[model samples]
Target: MMKNYHNSSLSLPRRYAITAVQAAAFFYFLHCSFLPFPAMQFPFPAMQCDLELSQNVIEAYIQIEEDKIEPMQTESPQYMSTWTWAYMQSFQEPSWHRALYKHLLEKLGKCSVLFFPIISKEEFHFTLLTFHKNERKWRHYNPLRSLGHRKEERCIDMARNFVNIVEGWLEYIRPQAQVFIETKKKPTLVKQKEGLPTLVQKDLTPTEELTLNWIMQNPLQFPFEDDMECAQQSVSSLDYGMFVMFYMDKIAQ
Candidate 1:
């Protein structure tokens, strides 16, 4: 499938990136008449933010879908199949094969909170389109803004691979779930450190422990002659400190 797509067309994703030259543009993309969907009344239960989508975005998508249904009644079924595949490809970021590799990661001062436990940002535009999907859970509307571009078959395969990677990470974190569950069942014993007041809990999250351990194991000890700035910091002690507030009972232990 990939080989055939690579050989025949610009692939769905790549073609979608640049203006013009896409398969949809040739086969009456915005050319077909549009059936207007009522403007955002509600995402599911409640209406989203006050901002409605641009008129062009709404009309462009609606017209794109009408032609596929229009052809189903006619004699040209083969063309319809091609059309269906082409439309799906248009949703992907790019119709071309490679990615633009740019180093976006920059260390802004550390932040730890509920939503963002650790905020390591890279240089990329942050899209702000939020919508709740279901009754119980609300998730970010479109996360694809962060993804690299790809051609059609490559895009599909990459999407599947990404989900598999996430599944593996969840599997890896399964054991850590026991920490929270078991902590509630039985109070954990602590081995207090000797001498000074500094202390940290043993049951830090996997990420926290890994970060502290990596810093300790590989000290950022560059020679005075070295000019690298990535490793340097204003407050080295606090920057490397691990916060374990697990034992702190504010009311009175």
Candidate 2:
């Protein structure tokens, strides 16, 4: 219907106006229903301001290693029910977390969400997962429960949100890198006229020193997950069928 309207014999200007209006409406809806990465506020404090920012990522990621060993498990009930469950089950855990997430993946019958590892500096993480209906399969698990659906609308939002959400997560986690190696690497490859360039040894950069100082004082900001990234792929029914995996590397100085 919207497409046919564009093909009508309206004046060139009228047709153009219609297209612009359609585009504007589309963008408005997209923002309203999806991509709700609002700036941290009263309801939700900013990731930066709520806690201390770390200058080192390596040692910080290590200090919180134990917490990552046991991630929350949601993959199981996610497949069997239609009721709306909790907010997230994103990855950041190591051993038990993987086992639980795997178990849940096999049984999901309804929707699946992509998540950013919510690494905690205070002994826990705040994973962010998106909910999606597994429409490709027949199931009684949709929480929406028989309302008319918007296939295209949801897909577009999911697509846009996927990238923005990862970036938003990055914004929240980047400061942790300050904990490991100095933020500014000392100039190593100096060019000397002789056979080899000499390496100038110096103390940690001020930023690096500052990060270490802060961590010793305030380790509550569980900075370990700073080494983590989100699942690289977007979600789909097959995704609902299997578990998503994101990789994390311990920072080596």
Candidate 3:
């Protein structure tokens, strides 16, 4: 008969040591798989470590380049969103629309006129109209003109008609008004007044200075001279009244 042998031949201490070694080896394999050293070799490729290293280097380089770039200088608000900032910058340069509008105004001889009744200041009106020496009647162009019964229901029909007229005029004059390059004057630097308090000063003509002094002296009286020519070319009551009000406001401030 053979002698019976015990299955627990190895001691508990030895089993514990073997289990700890296996656990350590498994964790070491995992670590090497994810973060392998340049000199180390593993059963599987260490793609995770290589990818992370490359991505980190690229991100660092991009951050450095972005930090070196200077901010754009503009009159727009500092905290404006990206799209708004871009839109504002788009209009900063001269455009064809602005050029066309300026040409149209020059051709039309447009002027802003303020009218007030001779006896009363209550009938003050400001109008934008084209001035024509040959034409007997004034041509008033009110883009906001409407025939709607309610004030709020007014539409921009007049404005649309005006735009169509401008387009037709442009087409008619396209051949003669072809775009041509004009030489522009170089910008000159203005010397700052050093060691002086900031003050607003304007160089006025003799006539302007005399008129201003007279207006200041006789703020309430009418500014028109007795001569017929002077009366014909006299300043508008609305303009004179506005100037007086502005002066008073400034004094109060």
Task: TM-score winner between 2 and 3, please give it.
Answer: 2
lDDT rank order:
2, 3, 1
Top candidate on lDDT is: 2
Model 2: per-residue Cα lDDT over 31-126, one tens digit each: 223221222222334433321121112113333442443233322113111001111223332322223322222322211332222222221112
Per-residue lDDT for 96-181 in model 3, tens only?
22323333323222212111101111112111222122232223222111212342122222223333444454454343221210
Model 2 residue runs over 4 Å out of place are 1-86, 89-149, 180-253
Model 2 has an lDDT value of 0.27
Cα TM-score per model:
0.19, 0.19, 0.16
How much does candidate 2 score in TM-score? 0.19
Model 1, range 145-177, lDDT digits (tens) per residue?
223443222433433443343234334434554
Per-model lDDT: 0.23, 0.27, 0.25
Question: Model 1, 181: alpha-carbon shift in Å?
Answer: 3.6
